[model samples]
Target: MRSDLSRRRFLGGALALGATATLAACGYQEDTGGSGTSQAWSYTDDRGRKLGGDRPKRIVAQVTAAAALWEFGIRPVGIFGPSKLPNGEKDPLAGPIDLGKVQSLGNVWGEFNYDRYVSLEPDLLISVMYLRDELWYVPAEQAEAVEKAAPTLGVDLAGVSMPDGIEKFRTLAKALGADVNTPRINEAKATFERAGQNFADAAKTVNGKTALLVSATKEGMWAGNAQGFPSSKQMAEAGLTFLEPKAPGDGNYWEQLSWENAGKYRSDIILLDNRHGNLQSEQLKASYPTWRQLPAVRAGNVFAWNPETPFYYEAATEQLDRLGSSLRTV
Candidate 1:
């Protein structure tokens, strides 16, 4: 419970709408002169805040945002989040960027180096937002300083459909001078579309088989709310049948269930949270007798999942393909 409580403390917070309002009222400088010499960029973020200024060359972004931008040829000068694995391996979410070239301000949640962030002189800051909570990756305590440093933009990952979210990132990248029509970029998009089809076909084959997405901590197990998580919603749309908890807990993201009652929902396949330190579903089964009794665990049908995975086409395609394969076999 200590770990879960600490995670909630680090990731949970009320939006500083007052700060957002103040920043919005200040108004951004629009390059109306139409100077042909220097290109100007403007974008309306998910929060409906208009952000306009000279094209940003030095950007600071959350790990997933940075990865999306990297695919579009816009590299951030600094990135923050869990960028490395327990074995010091680069996180898959950060796969598009050369970590050696970027400044790592902080690698864990709630850890930010003000001095290093300021030194980067970023023109823009980007992160993902969970619409229900209106909280972005940036912590509430650091919001003011971070906003002061540069115009902040949030990709509304949870508010819209997954495809729409990906398109928004593409639009932002295009505004930032990305060549969206490049052969490589187009190939990635096509690949993603094919992966989506594959996933749907796989799910269709499964028919009545059900999947459960859950995260296990020492205190208990939490089931993912299909309606709350964009990825889970996408899977459901693609034909995957996810069991919804009878009683969704706080925020509609998860249902807290004690380990003893972990078998409450019988699932043919289990998607285990694989972010950084969370135990793999197999490991959980090995540790908890009750968890071992689950049909999915007993049948060895568990797959890893990263709830905060990058929304870029390439990453999304890979993840979907993995799930599709898992479904086809399970």
Candidate 2:
């Protein structure tokens, strides 16, 4: 959670910029849908630069990036980042990726295991970029070391809408030889399309209700900026009117407020950041006097919100279904 806020390195200034499907690692297979031959593999990431190799068979990726590719059928040999829960259960964001088979280089912030990474004999490394040049979980100090070990591919998840983010991953998966057009993947995509409309329809039904997205703390609250986040940006554009926070400070994605000033933004509903580390909504409402005063909290209109990174269609569909169902209720 916020304890490692420094590692968040989220959208600053201009702001940067799925589904569950089984992505089983079948041991670096052939790319029927990609790689025109010669055994040489190359992928041009969001940065518009080429990261190529001998049609990379052994790949390692950030957890979320693995989630996206897994659905499309491109399995990584290893993964890093928040790959599992504190309780040792796999993070749901991991989707259906079986962590038992994939080597985990690190499971927390600032914990990239360089030696273990080299031990895997990785051919390519993949991760999503939150800021233009910042790879989500690759520690800055180890960037050079990691890059030297294997060609790293970074896909930008910021400064773009959710659909764009999802498509970018699909593109990457295709380059890696995943047949995204498969029946299962196509069904998931179709479900996502329907989910988008479902949310739009729900937004219309709850026409004027304003939803405020936030992360609460004893000190105060950090309000989310819709435009700076892909999922929220797509939702906002679809008619889920979110309270737009002014003056986004150094963290271009959030507006920090003290407990005394928490009332600056009022909403008919609140989307609480449900990521680990933050006090849950009910807990905050019961313990923090300032939190209890918020109109949405007192009205019991709080719902969970997560950034939803790496870009998968199935996960996006699930998130949309939950948000739409919640909005229609409140």
lDDT of 1 by residue, 225-258 (tens): 7766656677889888999888875656778889
Q: Specify the highest-TM-score model's number.
A: 1
lDDT values for all models: 0.76, 0.76
Reference-based TM-score, model 2: 0.88
Residue 259 CA error for candidate 1 (Å)? 0.6
TM-score of each: 0.89, 0.88
lDDT of 2 by residue, 27-122 (tens): 133234665554455666666545544577899999888988888888888999887778888776688688888999888777888999999998
| Candidate 1: residue 204 Cα off by (Å) | 0.8
Model 2 lDDT vs. the true structure? 0.76
Cα-lDDT of candidate 1: 0.76
